[model samples]
Target: MEQPPVTPRSALHTRPKSQGCFLVGKSLKPVVAPIYKKNGIFYAEIFLNWSHIVGERYSRLCRPVRITGDKPNATLYVGASRAVAAEMFYSVPTLLERIHHYFGFQILESMRFVNDFSSPHMASTFSPKKEEAAPQNSEEADASWKGDDITYPPLREALMRFQSYMRKIK
Candidate 1:
């Protein structure tokens, strides 16, 4: 038996100056467009921005399932329950208008309610969330204080109150 000379792994595989694969100056859009068309999710922005498009009320209860057809005649299918579908029936026009307004053009011609589609928050009705107002005390004054980190909760509260008072006097 005879053994051949061994070469370093790095030396065996040399890096090429120009690496070309498949082709250059070619686009993959043609390949991906068919997949998107077949999946019925061509307009991903509609689904991703459903919350902004439909507003808080419907955004929680409804979701964009798929968009069918081409521009000027495209249909948007939304997932909702039977009750939600009925509740949303009258507001379809309003929602469609909002969707169109969101995109700045009429990408969707109509919206169809899909009862077959289901989601976890279908039956939930949520009240508009209230934002808590910031404290009246000056934030700059608090930031201006060069105090060590206080481990005690009560001491921190008292220190915050003292800072508030000092800021008021100044």
Candidate 2:
């Protein structure tokens, strides 16, 4: 697949560059966006998924961390409780073992946990509806199906052809 050319940041905007920092319009504050390299390497700024954390006692004690990397390299950083940390001083190896098994080797390197001040907010509660509503019509149902384009006839013909081919092989 052909990719669109990436416009250099310098060409798109006028800003002073110094020590890997860039300025945005009128604000002295630096603007930073996570830029992933083509080789599936990237950084992730993550906070705990508090809803999931708070619900489970074990997970809450040893807070689970989240990390996002560029495509094919996203990872989650899991932390341990003080006691757990003390017991296993060399924690990275164990954590890496779990991560490698769960997410595969390409996505993760290591885990880092610190006494960060922030915690993510939990979602509010909502009542489950007693009776779910049915779709009004076929048009509404078809509209709800996600995709850029829909060609049912061609898809149906393809499926029929595949089934015929399978039967012949059997």
Best by lDDT: 1
Question: Over the stretch 1-170, how does candidate 1's per-residue lDDT look in tens digits?
Answer: 98998899998798766755655325767776776775444377777778877899888777888778887698988888888788998998999899888878777888888874455474344435689665567675467564567878888889888887887898
lDDT of 2 by residue, 91-138 (tens): 556555654554345445545664322222121223344796668985
| Candidate that scores best on TM-score | 1
Show where candidate 2 strays beyond 4 Å: 1-61, 68-76, 79-83, 116-170
lDDT of 1 at 14: 88
Each model's lDDT comes to 0.76, 0.47
Given candidate 1, what's the lDDT at residue 160? 82
> When superposed on Cα atoms, how far off is each prediction in RMSD?
14.6, 23.3
Candidate 2 TM-score, C-alpha based: 0.28
